[model samples]
Target: MVKKNDQLIVTIEDIGANGEGIGKYQGYTLFIKNTAVGDKVLVKVMKAGKSYGYARLMEIIEPSAFRVSPICPIAGKCGGCQIMHLDYEKQLEYKEDKVRNCLTKIGGFDKITMEPIVGMDYPYYYRNKSQFPVGKNKEGKVVIGFYASRTHSIIDTDHCYIGADVNIKIIKFMRSFTEKYNIEPYDEVKHTGLLRHILTRMGYKTGEVMVCLVINGKDIPHKNKLVEGLRKIPGMKSICLNINTSNTNVILGEKVIKVWGETYIEDYIGKVKYRISPLSFFQVNPIQTEKLYNLALEYADLQGDEVVWDLYCGIGTISLFLAEKAKKVYGVEIIPQAIEDAKVNARINGIDNAEFYVGAAEEILPKKHKEENISADVIVVDPPRKGCDQKLLDTIISIAPKKVVYVSCDPATLARDLKYLHEGGYELKKVRPVDQFGHSVHVETVVLMCASSEAGKC
Candidate 1:
């Protein structure tokens, strides 16, 4: 009987995927944002349905023990971090439970081994990459920051709690530079102005930084002055421009123009040096990336003589890691630029056993297996959010690698794909969730599966 604008007091019992609190009142489920489990809160129903409804948190009558004061003053208003209000320990626990629940409820795994989640000792300031949108506020001054939750409206802030500390300096420089030149901030509504977004990437180990300004036009006014100002900053290695003349939500365009310095910045992930360009799909967190990849390598369990196939290998991050232990590794990716980067990374690292191919994994893997009779003893797949394609799954089953290591970003799609693999005669062995994104609801999980015949043996 609950309708819109109904006021009620509810006890939060669970947290949803997006970090919303779930509470039940008289058999009706209410989802409220900015509230955590074990909290008793007053809420007003925003959109009421028959069995479930969305509500807005009015007041917290009692706070959860796991809840903590977020380091960022604008944590609740900014869309960057979802679960920052929750303690880091509880955040790890929730992510572990999320993976377990997905496997049990969605994958139908009645019994499965799940290891404890690997978390960072210090989660804040871990992000090596940050993108800020540029726009004008109500007062007609240039504003730069992340968008508010679920809205395109930018929330002006000098610093992001989770991003690299250098981001603040960069933002400040841009604010002043824009003001001095009277540069126009891109207006998404009217499709006018010039600068749209600013992207910055840092090499956590190398202390190298790259800045790419996304603009609505091909060039920026007073580009030399902008470059000079940016070069004054420490570790400034690359300054570039990304032209996206089209009116679209997508951040980057196909063309990238180097304004100053190098076109790419070099970084290391476990001794493997990688040259990261502005368009590269590198993991944002370097500390946790090492842990995550090391876990994947352990799951791969290469004996120094195994032939491994790395599917959807971006810039050869995981592929090169596996190649260090495996006798030979073949990496397949759909993006040509990524494959080129992978090749360059392998050569730069002096790794001769790794090879890169440019094509869709589903199409290329099967063709290679058929034409070259290339069979792998172990297979590693780091698929996108949508998970592996059915054809790729079928090919893996047919190849029958002794060990199949799957690195997933989405738990739901992962569960669905795991079900497909399990039905195809693979046994789920070990599942470990890694907290790559600390406060965000997103988590990365690495799973180990073995052929049915070699289940317990592995």
Candidate 2:
């Protein structure tokens, strides 16, 4: 029944919360991509494991009701997004169920309850920010696009389903700049190039956009010429240069120097204006972020007088929100630039009750607790895909805040963090999954945790 690279016909039994197809063949697990949960397909095993195997669907014998035609031509090959073929309503259910299952199956919480997932009003074009890598096409024409998820290669794109028109135009505009300079693409193996990345951020309501040009070297030849062209972009907040020469392929280039235009982008939410710099981390979707943050503030049960700690608070979005109602809010982050931006944002909004600290959550939180000898009523963590560090979870337990709000972009990491928190005597009282990016597997989750002694089981 099982052999190396054996072809097997199997029905997709279920879907993991991450949108990975779930199937089993003779007690061996198989994860196949681009297939719906109800589809029966013949798959060729790509890699076999002791317990689980990776596969690709070679033949679809029976199609599932959830399956729909994918609009993107490179949907399967590009690896940018899966579940694009699934119905929108079904996608919502899958994300919600994925969060619930994680609480029950992984966290082992008996009384866990979940609210309905928050569906986006306008899912497509929900992302107001996007970063595209600039490279060359087959004809050697300058092409800017996202990387192919499957191959880690460039997927030459003109207009992404999620990016706004302003960003698309900018990308198209970059072609001439790259061509004029004859900037060679940075090959990971060879490691030679001038250009690296083009990052763009736009505000849905304010109509302000920020674009940062990242290069592999500090002194780009004919930098003045490039600056002239980049500044010509209408409504461009910043057109600075980032110098990144590391062996790693991380999009961010170190040592950003102001070439022309402002160095930061101004993004507005409600009545508050937040300035986002080249290195600052902000939510790509501004429309849903308002909903996301407000819901989180409600879940935190903030009372304007309570002390709130926003961990990994990039540019202090949540801390500023809480500052409106809280007596004092402190945001701790490792990126000092982001902390500086947070400080500026607070000052800009006349929010004197908020402050920013620069450091990792796992280290800074405990130090603040011990050195300051203070306890917080609430804690909010909006961590990267890697989730909260274990040490930070331990510190959170020691501090024992009455309320904890966790915002995550990845479900698997969120679930892992939840398990750790559950072990630390926190119960998952409520959770809501919000889909900010449509036609993609991306989901944003907000979870509220309370002290088990005061809260009922669940």
Give me the candidate number with maximum lDDT: 1
lDDT of 2 by residue, 319-434 (tens): 89888888789899988888988999999999998888888877877788899876688999999889888888988999898888999888778888898888788878888888
lDDT (CA) per prediction: 0.94, 0.80
Clashing pairs in 2: 111-458, 112-458, 304-325, 304-326, 304-327, 333-359
Worst 10-residue lDDT window for candidate 1 reads: 360-369
Model 1, residue 364: C-alpha shift (Å): 1.3
Evaluate model 1: give its TM-score: 0.99
- lDDT for 183 in candidate 2 is 72
For candidate 1, the lDDT comes to 0.94
Mind giving the per-residue lDDT tens digits that candidate 1 earns over 1-458?
89999999999999998989899999899999888899999999999988999999999999999889998999998988989999989999999999999999999999989999999979989999999999999999899999999999999988998999999999999999999999999999999999999999999999999999999998999998899999999999999999999989999988899999998999999999999999999999999999999999999888899999999999999999888899999999999999999999999999999999999877887788889998889999999999998999999998889989999999999999999999999999999999999889999999999999998789
Off by over 4 Å in 2: 4-8, 24-28, 137-141, 221-233, 360-373, 456-458
Error of 2 at 198 (Å): 1.7
